[model samples]
Target: MLPSTSILFLCFLCCLSPIVPTSLNLTLPHQHPDPEAVVEKLQWKLNVSLSRRQMLGNDGKGTSSGSPSSFSCLTGNPIDDCWRCDPNWASNRQRLADCGIGFGHAAMGGKGGQIYIVTDSSDPDPANPKPGTLRFAVIQEQPLWIIFSGDMMIKLRYELIVNSYKTIDGRGANVHVTGGGCITLQYVSNVIIHNIHVHHCYPAGNTNIRSSPTHLGWRTKSDGDGISIFGARNIWIDHCSLSYCTDGLIDAIMGSTAITISNSHFSHHNEVMLLGHSDGYVLDEGMQVTIAFNRFGEKLVQRMPRCRRGYIHVVNNDFTYWEMYAIGGSANPTINSQGNRYIAPADVYAKEVTKRVDTDEKDWTNWNWRTEGDILVNGAFFVPSGEGLGVLYAKASSVEPKSAGLIQQLTLNAGVFGDPRDSVSVGFSGGTTTSGSSTSNNGGGDYFGMIFGGSAAPPPPSLTITTALLSLLVIIILNSRHPLLYYIHPLLKHST
Candidate 1:
């Protein structure tokens, strides 16, 4: 039999192993070293940014109509407000690599990649586009920071399949991806899409398409979501405008995790966003998404979003209007809604924002869904059901919920950065005018190159709770029978 110390050590590990979420598998990729650690880092960054803005003695208020030099560094828009208004923004391009918030805080996309300019707007050939086209930039084998040279609208003839390690920055141009196919990120990782307009995406597929510089595949009929993520991880989608999609504005599925969708606008669409694939798709249970600081505006229907069995953080966004409902779900997904302003439409029957689709109270009531500090306007109401407040709060993965009053300021600058070259008019759906702007080098990066770009390697594999526990069990059993197990002998010697 094993000695007392060996048995105790094994017991300790086994007891601790069950802390792993039920959705994880043995080969989970891009798992954080410690998610709590990432969250802590994000909190610290946010605090420092806010504190610095306070020290400057100027809030992100007034107007974006003035010259770029006079723009407010802190726009009161939580995402853009954090770093958009600094006059030195053009010189600090890589600061955006550090500006990621929520679950995708670690997704440093194309941080060390070479800058690739998309100078051509024509996509005369979908299968083989010109070297300077947007399609060409995304399919490159190496990491690339893609930027546009000027204002151009890309009417893609096919879905733009993107490869790994890319950042499509549309800050300096009036770039719009509309009137045709949209973006597809599948089986790739570490992608950042910022400051572009993706709207009116129509479906186009059932043809051969180049996914990368090396491989071309026959794609099925595509659902023209503004963005579609499948089997991908470490993604950050920020500061874009999405609307009028054939399908979901954005959708993540097939075990995709570690994502943050922040500081963007979505309007005039049905089925806005979808977090997981389906109820029976067990791999999605491992999905974790952060939906923060976005705007759901102007004639949107339901599923903003309809989730499956994943953990989602919906925080500090502006829901301007929802016709049927705002947030819906099935399969007992855990939704933590905090500090958002949900302005329901005048339709009395649709005032309720949360929908437990195909689920009765007896089932979904046991699901962990909580609403904290949310402002429900125009008779908007949220029906929450789940564990007690203490239990739910303890299990929540997000930062402390901020006040609902801050929603306007947090989401003030939703959508892509406005071009200083054009005049913009500010308006609001509810009762407040949000701060708006159209500039590229907002606060984080310089116009052309950011400092954080490097040939950064993907993060090392992390230990899951289940894996740790199983290893401990094997160690214990071996130690009990063969105390001199060769592999563990060193550990045993150290212990002794």
Candidate 2:
């Protein structure tokens, strides 16, 4: 008989042979030799050094410094004037004086505008305040929630730009803005709009009457964009929830830059965020915007904002059930999309490729090349052609004829449908020709319907088979090791 040690060694060698699982058919790409090591290296590179507050700071400090003046100090019945009658009012009278509409005047001094209090329902009347007027007032000890009862709408005639460092302190009461109108800001910086619920604004373009032509305009169609910012910079929109209107949830047209939108939830809108010009020209600089830590869900269709010649940084946003494109860019913009959690449907990959192809054919080679990183599970490639275009590659299955046909369609649709991805083909792909259209369509098309054909069929299950086999092989190797090869078994065998 073979010696015990030799027999055990031979058994170990037998167990060491490759064990493939029964369920697998197709070959899998080789597993990375050290996946954990690869992840470690990537984490080191992608780590962001700034803290959450530091990254989202308004005016260099991330925190809101003071309580809003609108609701600061108050007892019972501010409109009734009972709190002003107290005996100890002298010591706290300064706090009460500081409590009203112009509380920030000490800090603001003469540089900011005056403060006006709207005590009655008559204050917002266009006639009372008059048009092109600046009225500042404090409601005095009244909870800020009182401002929402259609009282603020009376001041519609005057352009109500909250200067003098105004704060509508809620003082534990909720202040909401309902009904729709434009709030215009001129030469205003270091502004903070916080802790307020603004909703049910009337749709834009519905009313025939007009406010100031240049500073403020009439309510037009409710495209669903809740708020409007005209020519404002260093603005921070945080901790707010907006719903139920028309167009985009937040529309930044014209040239508005250095804006940060963080820690908000958006849903039920067509275009959630829009950053571009209405006329489509390259301005001096586009909007420099950052979107982070927001949650999105169940969009009706593609709802990405268009960024033109701007810097957009999208990080750490969770997208649950994105029915259409989660994020998209346009114009000659720079977009950085990183650290996002996305749950996309199966056809997302095919749809994305088609969109890119369509975008490249438009705009006559004006599309800028930027970096894009996406994570997909069990996706496949269908190349319309077998070559890589500039920053664009046909999937593996695309033949030259099919690629050419698709390119031709893309060019024709360019004039009618603008590039949604805002890509223009500058150079030719290998064995491909460049084409153009006469008119501009602003990157709109039915490419998705064509690429997907009908309903989006589920992808094949080949990936599942490969994964099962790898797991089975690992299990087999671990279990097959010798029972008596280690220390406990060697002594017993030797005694026997």
Candidate 3:
């Protein structure tokens, strides 16, 4: 054993460390607001917004179908049908703001913002984009709802750095971003990228690129991700077709949180989605992402996101094919796979959906990766890990699981739809709405749950917090009995 002096020195060093409070009882007087009351208020706010939209569409009439009076049967996919079938959908494109499901449900991308029309497809100068270009619309600091005037393939000279509060709406047009650098959302918030095709993104640049209207900085080589969410939050990417990117089609990294990638079709990609930056990046622990109602189809290999450390809610997506494992992660991410349809390839080697990258079985066994109500086809298997309990699984899941059979219907209209038609118009034969649609043709009540639903789990126990708290508590209890006791007493008092 070491001498008492050495023990005392070690204790002194421990005292210098920060003290973390336990169970935090962060609930001060009225701090612990009633959760139900908060939910009800939020529900009311959403209702009022929807009702106001209806009023505006109907010119004060009480018609739930908005204007034009012609109503189609609900598609049962609450998120897609919420605004897709509306006759005034083009006019009220902002209604998509209310359509997000999961952690990003609150991402009201450019809602209540002025509309900006992008008439130009050319990007001659990325640093100083013309007013009519997509780059210009995205760089503006103000909230903007951008719409393409016509179908066009935009080849970017550099990666498009999108600013906060921007919505790139690609409905009613076949907008393809290809053969160049794609979108990068760095340190921005509340961005919605919908109904666009993002493919063939090539790495470019070691030059100045304009991030915002005022700021232009030299950017290093960007990994050709179709969409890169870096240090950003509240991002909703919906109804986009992503394929053949140089890197991940969609990547959320560097503490990016509150994201939902839903109703998107991802195909012909190698590395698909990536969440968190690196294995050692503990800041990404706060990341919460929802991957829902997407089609992971055709020639996809691994990492339908390879998460690092985050709460990843993968639900209701149709994984039609994958050359390699579908979902992978390391650093103990909490992955909740629910009601998804995973169809493995005939390659016997790639039958499993889960991949614990470079981790030992003993270590990965404790990672929270759970599958609930998933339909695994073609010998597809998910190697579930962690505490396989209802509460633990519920904590990881963002929304309640629907029937696994509904996966086909949920992702039926997965990609960007050029035209709005009855579910049959999307090419499904004998298309029928879900049971809920029969009673609620008018999208009402619990609309938030349609896309981004479910409250997050309580905070996980922190090792640093626990260790420091125990050490500090001990030193305080043994005050003056130890040499290091007095050193941390002031810190203990401050913490308490």
Of 1 and 2, the candidate ahead on lDDT is: 1
**Under the 3 Å rule for N, CA and C atoms, how many clashes does model 2 have?**
43
Q: Is candidate 2 or candidate 3 better by lDDT?
A: 3
Q: Please give the distance, in angstroms, between residue 114's alpha carbon in candidate 3 and its true position after superposition.
A: 0.8
**Candidate numbers, best lDDT first, in rank order:** 3, 1, 2
For model 2, residues 317-392, the per-residue Cα lDDT tens digits are 4444344465555444544443343444456443331122134545413433222222221221111211111232
Local distance difference test, per candidate?
Answer: 0.68, 0.34, 0.69
| Candidate 3 C-alpha lDDT tens digits along 322-354 | 887999999888787655666677789998888
Span of ten consecutive residues with least summed lDDT in model 1: 446-455
Native-referenced Cα lDDT, model 2: 0.34
Residue range 1-496, candidate 1, lDDT tens digits? 5578876876775676566453333234564534434434444555555455454545444334334344445654445654566557655665677778888877777889888989999887667768999999999889888888899999988889888999998887889997555998887899999999998898787777888777776766677788989868999999898888998899998668999999888888989999987775555656778888888877788888889876677767778877899899998776766556677677889988899989878877667666654565656777766641223232233344333345555666678876221111222223211111111221321111101101111222234565555544543554364645434322122111
lDDT of 2 at 78: 21
CA RMSD per model (angstroms): 12.9, 28.1, 11.1
Task: Decide which is better by TM-score, 1 or 2.
Answer: 1
- The C-alpha stretches of model 1 lying farther than 4 A from their native spots are 1-27, 31-47, 58-71, 76-78, 388-405, 419-496
